[model samples]
Target: MNIFPKAQFLILLSEDLFSHPQETMNKVFQFLELAAYLSEEYLP
Candidate 1:
């Protein structure tokens, strides 16, 4: 299975929602953090 590019996906999926600076950055960073943690959990 493949996950593709989450960052790009998130960006495209959230372009309009990210019009505000703080909220957009906050949400993106939060998703990044979660993605990192999930990656770590699946690491070999």
Candidate 2:
């Protein structure tokens, strides 16, 4: 059996970031196993 786990990777599109900043940040938080803690007002 393999002892090491696979690494995780997340890809963010520039268009999506510009179009949907909040959602994009949510995806990032989810990827890192963190709660959706960022709000729209905090995004650029």
Clashing pairs in 2: none
Give one digit per residue, the lDDT tens place, for model 1 in 1-44: 16775555655245444355455555666866753222212211
Q: How far is candidate 1 from the true structure (C-alpha RMSD, Å)?
A: 11.8
Tens digit of lDDT per residue, candidate 2, span 1-44? 26655556687897887788888888999999998886647445
- What global local distance difference test value does model 1 have? 0.48
Off by over 4 Å in 2: 1-7, 42-44
Candidate 1 stretches greater than 4 Å from native: 1-8, 12-19, 34-44
The TM-score of predicted model 1 comes to 0.37
Which candidate number would show the highest lDDT if scored against the true structure?
A: 2
